[model samples]
Target: MQFCDDCGSLMHADGDEMVCSSCGARVPKDRERAAQFVSTEKQTFDDVIESSEEAADEGLPSTEATCEECGHDRAWYTIKQTASADEPPTRFFKCQECGHRWRGYN
Candidate 1:
């Protein structure tokens, strides 16, 4: 990555010259092999949680499954990729009342 010689901002490859979008400075023939190591490796979880306003507007699918904690008759359910690709997806359920979470392997 090349930096702007005028404003010291990051420069990108634009054909033969490195062009700075900040101050419009062009550094010619200084195409150094710079690896822009942006951290895209982020850990993501499959926890299906929704806000109350979104749930009220979109309306999550409710099941007749009872909550073990508060004995709520309805729950919001979603299928999640919890295991290997050869295996089946797990079903995650959350209680609407008590917000209890549980999963079932299919």
Candidate 2:
């Protein structure tokens, strides 16, 4: 397995190319070109640590939606990134008490 020269992360040989998931550095059949590409990546170990700290500071909140019919907690929060909204902000919710769903926008 060839490690990414950029991030030192493991690189998997994907068919005709080796790709580094952490740094997106692709190593072609030519080892020389891959070395150059890895050097181009500007990320460092310190950057990774700083990013983790920032994420920890921004706490994740639990889902508030509940099931109305079964009286169960149906709320869940997704820590996924999304594109910026072009329209007004909107929220969709389902009640745990009766499985009732509603949408609110502001």
Candidate 1 lDDT by residue in tens digits, 1-106: 5568789898766667778989888877532443442323354555656656536523667788899999988888888788789999998888888888898788
Q: Write the residue-wise lDDT of candidate 2 on 1-106 in tens digits.
A: 4789999998865656888989889977566655565443556576454365434422334365555556666543333223365656555555534435555454
Error of 1 at 77 (Å): 0.9
Give the residue spans of candidate 1 off by over 4 A: 1-58
lDDT of 1: 0.74
Query: Which 10 successive residues of model 2 have the least lDDT summed?
Result: 74-83
lDDT value for model 2: 0.58
